[model samples]
Each structure stands twice: as C-alpha cells, then as structure tokens.
Target: MFKKLLFCSTLPLALVCGSCSSLYKVDKKTYVIEVNNQNETFNNLSKVSGVYEPRKTLHDTLTGNYLLRYKYKNETKYDYLNNYFYKNGVSAKFLKFGIIDEIHLVDAQNSTHIFNTDEDSQINNVSDFIHPDINRGYKNPIYQIQTNNHNSINSSFFNQKLASSKLIRFKIKNNIYWYNKDKKTDILINSKDIEKSIEKANLSSQQTNELKAFGIEKMDFKANENNSYFEIKLNGNFKAELFLDLIINNKIFSAYSDKFNYSEYYLVKNDLKHTLYKSVNNANDIQSVLIKYNAAGKVDKPTHAKHLLNEYHQGLVSSNLLDDFSDVQQKQLIRDFNSNKGIKLSVVQNFSNNIVNTIMFKDFIDEPDKNNIFEIMMYGKNKDKNSQISQFYSQNNIDFRNNITQIINKYTLNFIANKTNYYDNFISPNAIISNAQNTNYLKVIDANDHVSKGQINLAKNIEFYPQDLKKNYYNAESFLNVEKQLKSIHFESISKNLSNIIDDFYKENSNLKNKKINFILPLKLESLDTRIIEKLNKIFNEINQNLQVNIVDINSEIAKKYYNFSNYSTNNTIEYINKLLLTSNNNLINALTNSNVSQYKILNKTKQLLNKFIEQNKITVNLNDKQFLEKMSEFSIKLHNKFSYFEIIKLINEIKLLYSLPYNLSSNIDLDSFKYELIQPWIIKPTREDNLIYFEDIKMEGKNE
Candidate 1:
C-alpha cells in the first residue's frame, strides 16, 4: 500500500481515485493552467493541497489519485446539511446533492451511472448505501426531468462546483464530491510544486493536518453565546484589523495584513494536570517576532523566527493607495493584491457603539474605485467634543505628508442644495458618529479619547462678506430659481425696494444707505401634483412632498421616448405630453381631428374641452392637422411624478435669476447691488391637476408683461 502511494506521486494523470486503489495518476511532463489576470499559477509552491502548502505532505504517505479542488466563492450548502436551519428561523433551500440509483434513467435511451453519495445515507447510517424506496435502497430513477444541468435521480446533482470561496484547507477525501455555489472559481493544485513547498515550509509531516482541521473558510466572526471563547478566521481577522492599523501605525496594510511576525508563546504545564504560566513580551523583541512571522514556512529552525526583526527596520518598501470607499471585500481585496501599497478603506459611524470606526472594506465599498480619500478621526469621550478630518488623499503625493494632506483638506467652493448642504442641514447626521475636522489629530497617544463624540459644524452659512462691512454684497446666483421657467433670476428688485423703504424712515440721518442689509426672499407657492396631492390629501389630509414640481426624470423620459423616434424634439414631445397630461381623453385623436366633440368617449371629452377653449379664444397653440396625429404615448403618474421632482429643482434654480428684481425693478440700481436685493425668483411648473389655474391650452398672458 505504501509503495502504491509512492507511485501516485511519481506518476500523475487525470485519473479518478476510488477507495481501494482504483484510481492511478500517470506522469505526463507538467501541466499549467493559465490563470487570467493573476501572475501566480497553481504550481504547488505550497505542499499540502486544500489550503495546505504542498511541502507539508508526508514523504512516506500512501500514493493515490489526488483530486485538486478550489472554490473561489465558498457558499454554504447548509440547506442540504440534513437538518439545516438559517441565521434566522427560515427553512433552508432545496438540497444540491442526493443519492441516485446506479444506471439511473434520465430518459428512455439516455441512462447515466450515478456516482453521487447521499448525505442522508450517512446521517441515517453510514453503512446504508441506499434508501429503502429504491430497488437497492436508492432513490427511484427520476424520469420527469425539468432541468438536466444537475445529476440527482430527482434532479439533485449540483450544476456548479463546490470549491470553497476564500482560501480553505482540507485533507483529500477517499470518495466524496464537495459541492459549492455557482458564483466562485476553482484552481487545481500541482503536486510537484507542492513537494518543493513542503521543503520550503521546513516542517515535518506531523503537522500536515493542522491546516486541514479548518475544513471551510468563513468570513463573519462568530462568538460563542457562553462568552467563553471566540473563533476568528485567520485570513478574515488580519484583513480588517491591519487595514485600520495602517492609519495608527502610519503603515499601509493593503496586502501585508496576513501572517505578521508575532511571537507565539505556548505555555506548557510542568504539573501533569495543574498549572500553566503565561509570560509577556513588551515589544522589546517585537521586531524579532515580526521577522519570525515573515520567515514562517520559508526559513530555517530558529533563524526564520528572527527574520521578522530584519523586516521591521527595513521600513515599508512600496504601497498601493486604495480608495477610501471601494466595492470589494477587504479580505478579497487583499487576496487580490499582488503588492500591498494603498488599500481601499472606509471608516463609518456605529451608532450603537457611539463611535466612528473603520468598517471592513467588504461591508462598505463593494467595487472600491481607486480613490485616495483618507480621514483622520479623533475620538473624544464627550459626544459634543468629538472631531474628525476627512482628507481626500491623492495618489500623486501620498508618500509625501504635505501632498496627502492637501487632498484630504481640499474642498471646492461648490454649492449644494439645502438637503445636501452638510453645514446647514442638521448637525453632521444623527446616523454619523462624528463629522468634525480633525487636524493633525494625535489619536493613538490619546488613548482615552480614541473615540470621537460627533462631527464638528465647522462652517454653517459660510460667508463671502463680513458682518461689519459697510457695503458688502454676495451674488445669489447659486440659489434656487422657480420651477416655472428654465432661466436664472435675481429677486433683488422687490428686496431692494423693501430695503430702501425701510432705510428711508428707519435710518435717514444715520447715513445707513451703505449699511449692509441681511435679507432672504421666500416664495410662497401652491402644492403641485393634485393626484399625488389627492393621495396625500386623503392620507394625511395635508400636503407633504407633493409641493415639488421638478420633473427632471419625467422630462428626460419624455425626451428619450421621442429621441428614438423623432430626434428628441420639444415641440413634438410636448404634443404627446399634452395627450398624456389630458388623461381623460384620446388626446391623439383629438389633436388629429378638427371635428368638434365627436366619436368615442375619450375623443369626445378632449374635443369638447378644445372646442370650449376655441370658443373662448384661449387656444394659442396652432395645432394644424399635419402635426396633430403622431401615434402618442403617455406616462404613468408614478413615472411622471419622478420626472417632476428633479426637473422642478433645476427649473427653480435656473429661473430664479431671470425673475429677480432686475427684470422689473421699481428703480435703477447697479447690477452688483441688484444681485443682493432678494436671492432670486423660484419657478413653479405645476401640471394641470397640480395647478387649478391651468386649463385647455397653456396661455401666457403675462409673457410680455
């Protein structure tokens, strides 16, 4: 038997090995699988297959066919685990593997010999190879096949491979198929390279199974409810912790988080079953420990243990500045890293802990873009005194302290609406742990204040002018414009008039004409979206978010719908839009026919309204026959509502400058002075239902006025 095992290693080929020497591997030079996008090949640099370095295998081991398996996405097949329950109380999904009769019939002419082992057979009794339901205690041949992807007698074969995702370790089993989900990748480990790996690891075969004990790789850290102990995946723990320690130690822990040099002091009890002593190392030999870790599986007896010290003083070599927020799991990100330079990271607020800490890259950023944003947070015991500095770290000068700081502190003087104006909207958010500026925050040394209280409100209503200035003014170009028109406005006319009226009598002799006037204009507009209003009107019996007349999305949809057919014409689109708006009729036919109020119920209603408008001479749109009937379409209220919300805000901002005092000022004033009177006008674009004043054709009596 031992001689046979020796032959299996010396000669290898694609041969399936069963329990009693049925499978044999034939040597055929060497095979190399092309790992796309990865420089490392599966050439067995590490000996013990299944997360085990190949070199760790026993030289005197039995020879047999070794099935190299790898699963990049380690999905749990717990649903098939006999009595699987969920994280909650949900029943597990259908099983992926089950027993099938030998020569199972899939159909009349197609017969397949099932080699799958039923876990239920083991659960019931390891000796029971079959179920009592079949001829030989196996499942009946499932004839009614819905899908042939899987191989179960009753459609139970796993269509996907079950290689564990995340690195894992497991001893090669005799005759069993490991199942995995369809979302991961698999790689075959090479035996020859593994022998070299074992030599490189420099360990006897006694500890070969140490890694294999960790059967599966799990990412989530789980704790025993008894509070006795906690189990952490070696790979999972290092990825998250090191990524955070980078800021503290001023080290970039993108890829080098795994297997750091730390001395393992195992205490052996002198007394048979009595006491064991524990000792401490105050980092005097921390460098030595680091060297040992660095040389793990690579160096000699005691020398490898000391190499970590050499690594420490050598200083950081190179780094890849990752994004502040990435869309990848930190572990996977690190796993994907060929070099440890910058890493994608994110520090978020934990409301429960009342602290802001770095959330794992996996939890926050999924596909973390290469963004170099870094933030320094200073935690304080007092919730009110906590502060944080967000630095948009740039890749250009990240190695340089000066350049990195520039990216972090730089904020362009751009304007945001009231909702996004972090300075003015509520203090940092209730959800955020801290939102303050942390300048050169010495957090590590300040242990007690390692946690910040809250983000600071550095500049609310940041001003361009001083309060004591005699004639200071700020242009309100960035303010909101009414939704009615897509033009900018300056509302200072009415505001200046009011200001002068007040100054004339209030401070006539005081020479207060140059006194700066602190003023803001508020436009009182009616609620739009009566349908939405009707809904909310029924629900709360009051107006809520319905007042917004922005139709950005709807307008785009309207534009896009016609762009494919009519090249996105406003005029052509409007006609279809009008039909859509006139939900009560067949507006297409109404536009097509000059007949006054005739035909179908929908057609009659539209014509009746148009005829009434024509009799009243309120119809300004010259809807001739040629332009009337283009096959029309309408949008659902829900879709239209979405369009209105965004478009209205744009309209408001654009029209604000156009309708301001300069357009119809009571008196002449400089453009600079005129800019400050009232912020700007706000346009309101209400639908027919939203605007009670709107009916029939849109009539602008005040367009030239």
Candidate 2:
C-alpha cells in the first residue's frame, strides 16, 4: 500500500448507476483527451455497459457541445483515442495515468468473497456506517445459483452451486493482511530512520508486495460516477476499463464516484541509477541528465566533465568521482567541473552507501525530506578559465528505460534480460537499494522482549555465554555479515536467510524434531544497529493465527551454524568439509569433472596460501592428498627436466595463500570433545602416513587414533 496516503474526505463525489455518458470530447483548450472508460485501467465513471460511454451522456454534460467529461467504461477504444489526439511525447490522458490502480465490489463485481465458501470464497461487505468491517454482519443468505449466476439480497436459495472455473487466480502476497484485517498494521514498519543502501536491502518484503499490488484480472479505473480509488491498466490498455468505486457508508462501490488513484504505475526513470563518480554534474535537471550521461558511457568519472540529470531521474547512486578529464570526456573533449568540497548533501543525507563501496570509499546516504538535496551531477566543460555546460543538447530528464536498455546493449552487447535484470555486475544493485531508503525494499518485522531467568551473554562478538541470548539483538549483525561474506567471497548472496533454511532442513531430512530452537546472528551495519520494523501492515487476528516470522539476525545463523557444527559434523564431518571446500566444483554443470567450481577455486587458493606461508615462515611441508602429492612430485621434476611444465608443486602452494585458508587448522579443534572427529577432512596434519613427507608442524595428532 501507499505509506503516504492522501485521503480526500472533501473530494468530489458522484454516483454510478450502471450507466454513464460518452467519455471522449474536445476540452476548453480544444485539446481532445480520451477520458476514462470501463474495462482495464480503473475509472471513476458512473456506469459501465460494455460499450464506450454512449453519446447520450456526452450531450447531457456538454454546453450544447461535445464535452470530454462524459465517459464510457470500455478500454477497447483507448488506442484510437490516443491516435486522434496526436500529441507530442505522450497524450494528456496518458501523462496523467502514472501508477496503475484498481477497485473491487465485495458482492457486485465478484460476490465470491461474501459467501465465505472455501470453494467459492464467501465475503460480506458491511452496509452499516458506524463501525469497522468486522463488526458488520453478512446480509441474510442470498440465493445460491448454479454456474455463473448471481443472487441478490432478497434471494434465500440455499445449496445453490456456482461454478468458479473461470475465476482469476490473484497473486496475493501478504495473506495475513488480505485475510485477517486486524493484522493489517503488522505490515507497516513505522521507523523514522532507515538505512538507504541497495546492497543491504532485505528484498523479501518487496517481492511479496509486488505479488499483491498487481493482478492478472482486467479491471478499470471508474470515471465520473466512480468515486475513483485506483486506475490499473489491464494488459497495458489505458483507454478503457478505468474505474473507481463510490464510498457507500465507507464501503467500496462502483455506482457513484468521480476520481480514482491507482497503485499501478508507468515505467518511470525514478527507480535506480548507479554511475561513475568521476563525471561531476552541475545539472539544473540533475536527474534526467544523469540518465543521459550514464547512457552515453558505461563509466563516468569526475575527472571528465560535470553531468546534468533531468527531473526524470528519481533514484540515483553516484559510486565514484574521478578527477581525470579523460575518464569523463570519452575519447575526446576534456572540459569538466566539480565542487572540490564534495557534494555536501550526500554526506549529510544519512544514507546507506555500499558497505563495500563505503569500505572502498567511506560515504553515507542522506535522509530524505530533510536538508537532503541530491548532489548536482552536471554537464559542463572548462576552458579559457571559464566553465560551460554542453550547449549542443537541450535539457532533458533521463529516460531510465532507454538508458538501462542502452547500458545493457552497450555493455552486454547482445544481452538478454535474466533473473538478475542487470547488464553486468560492474555496478552492484545492493548498493543502490541501501543508499536510498527504498520503500520498495522495505519490510515489516516483529520483535518481543524476553524475561528469561536463565543466564545470557551478549556482546559485539560471539565469544560470550549462550544463555544470555534470549534478549539477543535480533542477530542483525549476522545478516550483514552473511551479505558481506557472500558478495566478497562467494560473489553471490544468500538468497534466503536462516529461517527458511531451518524449515528446508527439516523438510528435506524429515528426522529432526526440535522446537523453540532460536538462532542469533549479527547484521553488520556501520551504524552498529538496525531495528526490526514492518513495511506493509497486516491486520493481526488472534483467533486466526498465521505463521509469525522472527527475522533472526544473520549473526544468529552464523552462531547456530558455528555451535551446531559439532553435533552436525559428528555424524557427517568428512562429507560436510568436502562439501564446504568443494562448493565451486559442485557448481560446474555438465562438465567431465564431478568437481565443482568451488572445489577447483579452493584448491587453487589452497595452493597459493600454502606456498606463501612456507616462504614467509621459511618452513617446508608436503601433503599426501592425491592432488597435492602429485603436484609436489611434478614440481621436483620440473627443476631438472628440460621440457617440463611442472603443472603442480610450488604452484599449488601459491594457490593456497591466495585463498586465505586457516593458518593453523588445529585452532578449530573441539576443546571439549574427546574424539578427533570434530576436525578432519580439512584439518589433517602434515604426516609420513601418505606418499609424501613433511618437515614442518611437527608430529600428527591423529596418527595414533
């Protein structure tokens, strides 16, 4: 839902009684705009009878001339209407229609909600005006009819059947809010402060709302008599199907209303933008120009020239600012400008810069609605001790769709839109979301205080007592850490958090019977703390309880995994280590080697580390692991052979250091466990037990076992 709702109690009202006037005519400016009709995109029209508003209604509202207000309820003629206007860019009507919207009558449009039937989904709209929806009672039983027939209030037929084979399958994201009205507030996260960083966004909430805010069923934004609430385009048709409902005793109705707001939207350039920092912009229309500059080149640096973004630029992320003119000037032109003091607003904005980017360059996003003004990314050049903006092109808003398409084409060459929806990973999306307090990525979380008598230990690090965890800090640090470690090391993200993992673990194995087992994790944010707030609110219902989620901090996950490893690995240590080290090898698809990409990568990394450690420590050792031993034997032969590639040995050592494997595997030993089972596969000592020999790290601990 729209967090900032504009309720118009003093709004203009109209009545729709299943009839309306024609919706097309010349306005006062003689600028003809096709008004709302029935069928898709919502309308506030008074009536909808399939065809476009009849000419009869048009004459009734006109001053003896065709008026535009008289509209229809059909979207079929929208295209023809646009062509008739022939306006520049887009027609007047199209411009007004920004967000998509819709309206639904409990019993009129689809009475299924009134029946409360599992098969038919019955629902009853309250006719009373003094109370909320729940207090209202369902009208006396209406007649049930076979097939697609509807029953009125007077009908009392029972056991009548209705066929729902033709019903639309609406994708409802927040079931708690949809079914249970009381839990509605559960969705809205009311936090005045929020981190503005794309990299740190919890996308789970956003994806859920996306599924709810839209539907495949074609509806209209009612016009005129339709006290319009929303305008949704059904399959991109904006001409007809626009409808709004009249608030009859606070109930949504289609018979009377004037205007409607919609949740649907057009593709605007206000979504996201990430560009080189070097391209400084002194743009009056900073938003749009940023779009254009970013489009022209795959990279931008402050060293080139100032950038100018038009008003169309909604959300923008400036990653770097280079002082080199060549960086911004392309293959030609070297004029540029930038504020040496840096963009003040960005620094004071209370924003979320990519922790990585921040780590790369310490910065933060500004809080919105404050002294927060966006940095001016301009388009200008300096010469003769004077600076000048590019006069060749007039000011324009950045067309995000066009620029994104262009950026993708230029970078990817022959790119296809995949699940990632990005041209390349050159720019991280996480940084974009987190940098701006993106409402799209907002989530609603629930937290409760604990009063356990048990001892608990809480600290920044996990080296504390476990019992004190009942009041754990939502383990936010773990989530942050998970994201950090994932992007930095895995080059990927943990798509789902530990909560989902627990469910999946049980479902897959079907043997675990644990309950009330909570996980504590850390969420790494520079602010040091992030609160659990809700996004879209849900109406909490006591009797009808739903799956209450506790977003355990990623740290809790790490902690759980850390603590549980002993028990889990006790049963399957070798398999677990092999899986952990060989993750990349398993990633290889359809290859001759069963080895995963991670396996090869870890192996190479291990090689680098081992070699560096040996050289730095001035110690030498040999491993009898099949791959390690073979590589060592090859390295020995390379020194004396005339035509030897070596293909192993010291090269493997070089690979080890690069990976940063544990310096002393023995440190991970389970101090309490008597068995040597805790650390194997990955922690064996250099030994004479295999084909190779060692001169470092002394005797092996497990040889006797």
User: Which prediction has the highest TM-score against the true structure?
Assistant: 2
Give the alpha carbon lDDT tens digit for every residue of 234-318 in model 1: 3321221111111111111011112111111212222211112111232111101000011112223233222222211122111
Looking at model 2, residue 523 earns an lDDT score of 22
What residue runs in model 2 are displaced by over 4 Å at the alpha carbon?
1-102, 105-291, 294-302, 305-705
Assess candidate 1 and give its lDDT: 0.20
Q: Distance from true position, residue 222, model 1, in Å? A: 29
Residues 1-705, candidate 2, lDDT per residue (tens digit)?
Answer: 121111101111121221243332111111111111112211222222111122222111110111012111101101122222111111011000111121122322455422211112221111211122121221111111122223321112211211111122211112211112112223311010011111123324322222122221332332232222232222211111111100110012112111211111111221112111110121111111111122122333331233211110111212221222233332222121122221211001111111111000001112212211111111112221111112101111011111111111111111111111111111111111111110222100000001001111111111211122311212454234322211211111111222243344346434332333221222222212232112101111110121122323323543332111111121111122222232222111111121122323434443454356346645433232444333333222221121111222222222222121111111111111011110111112211111111111112222222
- Lowest summed-lDDT stretch of 10 residues in model 2? 443-452
After aligning candidate 1 to the native by TM-score, how far in Å is the CA of 255 from where it should be?
24
* 124 Cα displacement, candidate 1 (Å): 27
Task: Give all TM-scores, in the order shown.
Answer: 0.14, 0.17
